[model samples]
Target: MKRANFIFICADQLRYDALSATGNRVAHTSNIDRIGARGATFHGHLTPNQICSPSRATMATGLYPRHHGLWRNGVALDERLPNLWQALSRAGYVTMGVGKLHFQPLLAAAEREMPESLAYWAKPGSERWRGPYFGFDAVELVMGEANESTRAGHYAAWLRRNHPEVVDLYEPEASPASRAEDLKEVWKSAVPPELHYTSWIADRAVDFIKHQSNRPEPFGLFVSFPDPHHPFAPPRPYCDLFRPERMPRPTIRAGELERMPAYLAEGDDPKKDPYIASGEQPREQGFLLRTDDISAQTLAIAIAHTHGMVQMIDDAVGRLLEALAGTGVLEDTYVLFTSDHGELLGDHGLLRKGPPPYRQLLQVPLVLCGPGIRPGTSLGALTSHIDLFATVASLLGLPAPATDGIDLKPLIEGRATAVRDFLFAEYHPRRDACLYNQSVITKDWRFTRYPNEPAWGELFDLSRDPWEHWNLFSESEFSSQAHRLNSILDQGLPPQPLIPNEVLGAY
Candidate 1:
């Protein structure tokens, strides 16, 4: 148990049905559903490369984007190759990577074009992510988690220049509710409900895990959480803790977009996209933009304010798992919750996970509890997230280093000898609103291959449309399961001419 230390816990676009241990009867996780009752909860996990800095550079370099090519999201990861904190600090652990290390930098020296936002971030500098990328030894950068007063711009200017509210719950539009219609999430029918930014990223991730268990080695913390991702803000009695009259609508069907598949009915002039359009989302007064987050009255009050900000990030993952079982290190640390991708929240009317291979933005949520595994078990066969760098290098016995992923300790220990049986996905659209697509799911077929540029391609038959609401690649009744996941997405990935950003150029 001592050799295990890994505490990962990343969450951004979250949604594996926002957890109630996955049954989600309307999520409110009593401690992120007790981390699936203490470990092992695959639930068919998958997310090879689905946006967000190429899925946080394939989980900090377990490679895939054709082997660390970082397939898109403001480009940037050619950090001279080989990562995962340089193979867990060359096999000794102690990694540390607090909140949103979507890291950016590597290419700089005057605008050769890349700083498109963050007000032209130091010329080629702005690609989202300000520093320490993933070589985290320590990092805390929460200057703002979406404008509109959240953390009152610089945490209320450093709590009016140092702790004045004294927990009186100061308010700044309960800051951190940036959904942009000029930022929102207004609260205060009298104070007591402020301090938001998902409780300032869960009390700075439990005081950086109680300052890294007051040092003694054996650590790898990477606690990230940017809120129910995007300005569908959170903080104000968890913004009306869901009840847009029991929200939950848009399971999309009506005229079933005339039999999907021409790039999912091209939902936004990808030459008339109606591919079961569910593109934009954010309501309760505004947002819903991929040309309107399709009404059912703005998707039931934006899915009850995204299920009350996923029960306030499951009460901030139950206060970072009660500060890791009150420092007894919760059965010897390993805890690896998930989500760098996943959140089309509206499901098909897509809220924001950009256009491509949408299984509500490529099926994410790959829980793996801790030490050895099997606790309230759930593996559903397929899994990836580049196998968390060979399942944390086989839980620290080490050795799968420069990872391209695939060593899920024999499917989180239920044992089945899986070296991956068809599951791949990728889409690079830097933004023409969002469209490029490519997907290949297998243990029963789900191919999506949008080549119309704007982005569209789908094929689901989860044993006959399991709520994928029908989109069978021009049904010849599932042309041999969409030609066997498009010939395994044309012979799986990797081997593209990459590597060469000794700053920014080749890769």
Candidate 2:
């Protein structure tokens, strides 16, 4: 069989229910839906970690955050670690990334106040500058939301050259006086659709495909879109695409947090908690938007903008697909669409994601399309973002890396009913003490436990309460089930060597 080219696209902080295919009436994601229609959609896919850098590290290395040593947002990946792109490249595939490859934490340099290790890509003439980052032979990166001052890399350089007038919009500004008013639910970027980061990612991805279509070797392109995350600002028509009145409000019970673990319950106060601090303070300065007390109208507007961002990404996906078809590689290319993690979206009175093990923050959308894939199929098999490494390696006939994720090709080809019986996810806190939690999800239940605080945890009978309205951890009726799930977590991650035996054999 001939090896197929690969195009992996991911959106930042996109949730499982954001797609129209998921019966989301508010967000019209026709392009993403088309991918699902043409391939298999894994409905039970979950992320390994809930943050940007750690989850992405798992995707790249096929190892959990702990093993990879990037358990937090501000840590950098050990360059010596085995990378999926490096394997593909060694197998004679051209590797390229278009946008937002958060292999390194977003504000690492700024937060640590380092001089040599700048957070963004190095300048063209810098002595330490180099390409083929983290196994990617070429990378174009952009950090933060549309108006983020920290935005840099090829995207920033492109804006300076092509749209100099709007470059100032992305420049860093002073932190706002208070976060009480800025909840990150809704905002409008002065940037138009054509100049937006989503548009830039699509433009570069299409260009790369066009440039490499006639190459002798197969190519692997990672087209990443940084949007729908926060500062909920979508440009122009997209900002107005979803009306606030028509969007669904967050699922909030009167006292949902009352039942939560003590650590999680404390997040109910934005003024006291740092994680939920509204984006009024710059991330470099260590402040997050508080989602605890947002009003119904603000939450609705945020949802509308989030949907609009999804729509913009969907449109960009449409353009990239068109480029593939135009280049005559559409038939032979394999396309995978997913996200790093999910947003809280006002679910359970939370606006952003943190240590919580709620489904809204853990579950993500996974769509696979191309040759050998069953079209219009939905698989409920448990899958994780880490699985992409093994699956892609298998698809390309490359040597598999040491990974905790299993090969999902069987599930994608309809050859298996399920891949794994249970899925595990984790979050490690760096700045805050409360933001540390691990979860185990089985066919009928979701259980979470915190380190050093065994008595304080979460247990939900997902089969009965999918919304996770009740906590069963403290109830005696469900004590046995909780114990069993906790046992599974105690066993720890599946066996995965830090260095694959094959790589060692090369010595």
Top of the candidates by TM-score = 2
- Predicted candidate 1 versus true structure: per-residue lDDT over 296-346, tens digit per residue: 544555567667777777777788888988977777777778887777655
Per-residue C-alpha lDDT of model 2 across residues 317-341, encoded as one tens digit per residue: 9999999999999889989999998
**Candidate 1: which stretches are off by over 4 Å?**
1-7, 12-194, 197-199, 202-210, 220-226, 229-231, 234-256, 260-341, 345-348, 352-357, 363-386, 393-395, 398-419, 424-470, 482-507
lDDT (CA) for every model shown?
Answer: 0.59, 0.74
Each prediction's RMSD to truth:
21.3, 5.5
Which portions of model 2 miss their true places by more than 4 Å? 109-130, 170-185, 268-292, 493-507
Counted clashes in each candidate structure: 26, 9
lDDT: worst 10-residue window of model 2: 498-507
Our model 2 lands, by Cα RMSD against the true structure, at: 5.5
Top candidate when judged by lDDT against the true structure: 2
In angstroms, the error of model 1 at 205 is 3.0
